[model samples]
Target: MKTDKKKIIVSVTNDLVSDNRVHKVCTTLYSMGFEVLLVGRILPHSSEVKRQYSTKRFQLLFKKGPCFYAEYNFRLFLYLLFAKYDILLSNDLDSLTGNFVASQLRNKPLVYDSHEYFIEVPELVHRPKIQSIWLWLEQKILPKIQYAYTVCQSIADVYNKEYGTDFKIVRNLPLKQNYKPAEKQSDEKIILYQGALNIGRGLEQAIKAMNNIDGVKLVIAGDGDIREQLHDLVLQEKLHDKIQFAGRLPLEELAKLTATADLGLSIEEDLGLNYRFALPNKLFDYIQSQVPVLVTNLPEMAAIVKKYDVGEITDSLEPKQLADKFREALFNEKKRKVWKEKLPFAAKELVWEKEEKVIQEIFKGITR
Candidate 1:
């Protein structure tokens, strides 16, 4: 991990502390005998980060919206233009523009890591004009790109068809675990949900379902757009004691709580293709923690639960129906035993170390 031995510069738009996926990517690059310079933006409320590799976070005047994108991209473009690196790695569409422009100008290889279907996310699906702008950029740049990867196959298939690009799959998997399944001692349960508390994440339904279920506390971790609203809803429902808002914790701290959960929730509504094909980090984290998952019938999430026999699938978004499924997932002892036992197997197979092969293959082709 010497400073003098690297050739890659990675860029993203988020405050770097909570972005475990990008952090893992940089670590992988570092592990592959390359020094990595991870670049990002720092917000006023962003927590401090300490990592082995180098990082540079810009302070932007504009926090969000069009102005933010324009300003960040312009700043990133200038930084990447002069930075000493042979390869550029961009995470998601928001970070791609500046990296793309800089890569083209400097004749360096650019690798795109599309975390989700950019335009199909709930934020952009309703806004035609804004979505169209991103679509335009994606269409113009993707085809000509030589190297890229995405989180799941469903999204990769979409991009492969539309842009005729050969994008590889590097899912948001966690590092391998050495966890032991602990027997539950209390009748009380913790039904945990972690990740962005955004719209269409099924947080509202899960919160509402708490009223019908007894002796189970729901722990929601992470922050996002709908955080305040979800808190207000819990207060209104008078389920404050039953629902605990743990907010955002460091990666290590979150896993300790996840390991104690009787059940983990990843019930995202199919608001658009983004949610429908979603394979989020929390699902894998749950497996690593040896917690059984309760995921939606969405293709990617359900596929993991089914293939691994580590969890169950739910087709309902209603509170009462969801409550029923929650009860079964939590209390069905025979099924719970099988799930808890199978988690180690699933965790071994779907780990970040296994994914290093894909990373090596992609970089070999482009780095040459």
Candidate 2:
């Protein structure tokens, strides 16, 4: 079958060049013979430019203060006006409006990729008015969208059941197939956490857990709104040596750090629908690195942990209970080795290659 060799424009509200979901999809589509154009902003005076990849990035001016959305929409509108694309792939609800307008003008098919159940994001949980508005936009836009995809099964099911519209499931698995196997380190037992340090991620508990464990270090990678508080917690606990926050390391360095870990962490608090069904990238990263994961006993996370027999899960929410779970996971070598042994099988099976077929099928459907 001759695949569609077409130019695909991916409109992302956030910085697409930095996002894992967009990076995965763009790389996959490029491999499948689509020219991917990533339209988004580059940060103010940030010279950290990535050279390789088929993606042609368009830089939008950085906007300041509370009226950022207005500026974002304006820049996006201009990009849509000029850029020529066969298909416009919208990342989330924020970019859907621009895609809707662009598609209407260009008469191109639009694909809405939902990375989250947007209304269930932490930012929207409190602001009911904004939540209602966004939810309404989603309801209106999603049904009208010709092609759509989401991160996990739970999210896809929710969209289907709620909107009565069909969409594809594109799991957020990384392209890399092999990684360093889990091995015992002599100097420092590293407990790795690599994801957005959001409100319900239980970073505080992890910090406290560090206080209990000796000769062990907690490596917190990545950043978010809760980062400052986490830093403050480390200082308060006098765990400067114990808890090291290396914020937002690049993917290569991040993987290297993850590969060297004694154990991986993915402790998201059970907050809303998203957190309840959280399928984090860090879990698979841990798997690929062949490190045993110590994660929360959430449905999505537990399934992976149980299936591979990798590490432990804290079924309870209490900080002390979490601390105990961490102690047990970090201290035990035998169980960690067992989890390590099984990781190769799990890593091979649970990867982007397995998920690619479904994504390809969706594109085929759209093309036909």
Candidate 3:
């Protein structure tokens, strides 16, 4: 028997080890009979990727800044130009230029997945000249994109209004799992903050809040540019005994670690539009693990916290304010129990199984 399934190429800018969303998307597409080849650039520190679908990581000379983006996109453009792909999936704006140009030249369908508002990211906030380049790229490419999707409805609305493109909303939700939440092993509660240790993540405030938050250990997982700085901050505050940096862990390992935590934190500062409209995967990850969360009162996050009654939302990122909120959430056993009780219902609605159907239907409509 011969099956004729379309071949799809998915592109991203990061090494694929910690990208749970992209991995889930590729898995779903593979199950639907698509021959998937996930593409990304390799850094000197990138770990070997082992997966069921084919993956390629291009080694480039430059590692950061404009040089890296230009070189990587050029290589990606050349690769996509010559490769045999029925559909090209570009993840985020950084990868869009290469995929867009290649898709246009090759006359293949291109699906744009906007993970965040690229031009509004914190990195670009200080550099206007550099920001202009990305803004221009987005302005030119976005209107021409036939099919697009974003991680949240807020971002989707922004794109629709800005570019007149009908972008669908497919949230970056966690995969459904059967593992039961681990019982607290230690007397001290674990306060976990997972994901990239990047700026504008309110980590400084979180670390400062630890001074007031006793009988709890702050566990900072994942790696980013500010990891060393954060470590220094912990040491300077003389809170090394109370704070632990787990670095980056594989998604499976991270899940196991997340399950043990008593409370999860996602206190993204309102620095830009991207953070304002942000709906990070860790929020859902916390829910899936049946852990109560204490998130900042941003639109997307606040809406989830309010609607599901799964966690508390803090109004301020000030250390004292955050500390007060953490104390309230951690010590209030009745509230914590109530929040944990709602996790099953929240998890059912937020899992990737339901979201995958949207991706499948979109492909069915576009490919046919």
What TM-score against the true fold does each predicted structure earn? 0.97, 0.93, 0.98
Q: Ten-residue segment with the worst summed lDDT in candidate 1?
A: 1-10
Output the worst ten-in-a-row residue range by lDDT, candidate 2.
Answer: 51-60
Task: State each model's C-alpha RMSD to the native.
Answer: 1.7, 2.2, 1.3
Candidate 2 global TM-score: 0.93
lDDT by residue for model 3 (207-261), tens: 9998987899999999998998999999999999999999899988999999999
Residues 1-368 of candidate 1: C-alpha lDDT, one tens digit per residue: 23346489999999888899999999988887787898899999888889999999999999999999999999999998798898899999998999999999999899999999988999998999999999999999999888999999999999999989999999999998788765677879999999998999999999999999998999999999999999999999999999999999999888788888989999999989999999999999999888899999999999999899998899997999999999999899999999868987898898999986898877766655
The C-alpha local distance difference test score for the whole of candidate 2 amounts to 0.78
Q: RMSD in angstroms, candidate 2?
A: 2.2
Clashing pairs in 2: none
lDDT of 2 by residue, 1-368 (tens): 35557888886765543477777777777777777777776665433646235444445454543255556766676787787668778888877787787788888888888888888987778888988988888888787877788878888899998888887887777766556554656778888999898898888888987766688889999887889999999899999989888888777778888888888999888778888778888888888887788888888888878988977988875767777787788777787778768988888887887788877777767677
Candidate 1, which segments miss by more than 4 Å at Cα? 1-4, 182-186
Top-down TM-score ranking: 3, 1, 2
Q: List the global CA lDDT of all models.
A: 0.91, 0.78, 0.91
lDDT for position 19 in model 2? 78
List ranges where model 3 is wrong by over 4 Å.
1-3
Candidate 3: what lDDT?
A: 0.91
